[model samples]
Target: MTRYDFLPRLVALPGVYRPQADTRLLAAALTQEPLRSGAKVVEIGTGTGALALQAAARGADVTAIDVAWPAVLAARLNGWRHRLPVRVRHGDFEARTQGLRFDLALANPPYVPSPDARLPTRGARRAWDAGTDGRAVLDRICEAAPSLLRPGGVLLMVHSGMCGVEKTLELLGREGMSGQVTERALVPWGPVLRSRRAWLRNQGLAGDSHEQEELVIVRAQKS
Candidate 1:
């Protein structure tokens, strides 16, 4: 069973990203953290606020932020339905969370390698379409992590292994935060990746015979 199996059914609205393998992996990692009651937690690109709600149910004060209005609405509604108090807000993660530091930071940012160079500002593509290198959002998250967490605070972020997991660790290390991959699960490529199979293979992000993608959770701590 998943870590969220015991919680009430979540309400996922259209256009908002649905909690999938990455979300489940991050949730499992969250269970391993030593969270005390009333610990401050922030979830960036919160989608339906699944991870934030998990922290809230465990007594952590959670603030969830997303760029889409539909996601913000879905998160607020889900929090009410689950009886979990989460401060769901609609805005960019860095803009909305400025000047705030938390004990724990969670993220499931876009890491898909898209053919397009510019990131999407709207539409469902925004959920998963990163730039050609697939590090558009991932790099930003790693760069902002130090400012988002307090001393000794931890960051739990999940992304596709094709997006350069080692680069993520290196970026965090450069920022003085040590990090390593804590969880990994192989999942079959969904429609998004399947649609770009040929491109991915040509770009060396995927192989012709491979149909599965490895998802990994990176746990980084601020020193």
Candidate 2:
């Protein structure tokens, strides 16, 4: 069962990314993590702060960030409404580290492989469009995980398997972090994926008229 097996309803402001398969997949994996009491946690690309709220509910102090301003506002509102004490910040999650580290790091970043060569600078597209290979942000996170996590801290991140799970595991290993797929789920294509069905098929990221996509939750522990 997913931590969001009973995903609490949240007010999704216009233009904010709504929680979906990737979110629930990670949430399920989160329930398996060793979340100690009062453990300090951070979530990049928090979106509506749903996952951050989940971490908080586990009795962990949560800090979350989103690059989209509207998402930032929505997350803040949700945190306030739920009284989760999630510090929702609007900025680049990677650049705003400021030397702070966390016991656990979580993310469900934009991993939809798109035709566009560059990640969108604005709009809702920024929430899901990773460059052509869908590793733009994922690669950045893998590189930044070492800096964001304290020794032995764990990073739990979710993304489409279409983006290459092996690469993530390999990258984390290179950083001295042993990682594995703690959870995997095959979810049907949502509106976003459905709309880009043809493009995805052309890129071989999807099967012919593929109706489902695989999602994976990678759990990496920094040593």
Candidate 3:
């Protein structure tokens, strides 16, 4: 069964996308890394607390922040269920984490771009919706990541292949961060791709015959 399937009923509500393979890959990277036990870790978009819980279980001191109330609550509930000591809070990554530096930082922001790109609930919209290019939220995270991370800290993020991996790398480079692709897989894009085809076609692309969306895992370090 999927992690979403195993999640608590309350966490299975709308607007909460479950952790996918990218999440698992990121968790594994953190495990393999040299983060000491009780090292400070921050999770920017703690959807369902899957990654945060995993980090906390590995003995990292974790603080998970999400703008969505339900997501924060769900994360807390999930942490409680798993007996993990994760602090779930309702806040944005850039605004809420001022003066906080962590040994490890991770985020799986809403990298999907859509015209009707509003969250299912008002509370959840802020957690999703990355503006027209789908890079708005991710860009903000990249810009603020350096400040949020301690020296020699790491940042792990996942975004779409359609979101321009090269551009993301450029942004990271500009921020004095270096990253490498850790994992990539083609997965479905749900319903947004149906409407996005016209936009692609306008840019001289064809129909929506592609069934898979690219999932890219990037691990970066602050230099």
Candidate closest to the true structure, highest lDDT: 1
Q: Candidate 3 lDDT (Cα, whole model)?
A: 0.75
Task: List TM-score per model, in order.
Answer: 0.97, 0.95, 0.86
What are the runs in model 1 whose C-alpha is more than 4 Å off? 6-8
Candidate 2 scores a C-alpha RMSD against the true structure in Å of 1.7
lDDT of each residue in 97-121, candidate 1, tens digit only:
8899999999999999999989999
Across residues 62-92, which tens digit of lDDT does each residue of candidate 3 receive?
9999878778878888887777899888876
For each candidate, what is the lDDT? 0.91, 0.88, 0.75
**TM-score rank order:** 1, 2, 3
Over 36-130, each residue of candidate 2 has an lDDT whose tens digit, in order, gives: 98898999998898889889888898899999989989888887877778888789987777779999999999999998888899898999999
How high a TM-score does candidate 1 get?
Answer: 0.97
Instruction: State which candidate has the highest TM-score.
Output: 1
Candidate 1 lDDT for residue 129: 91
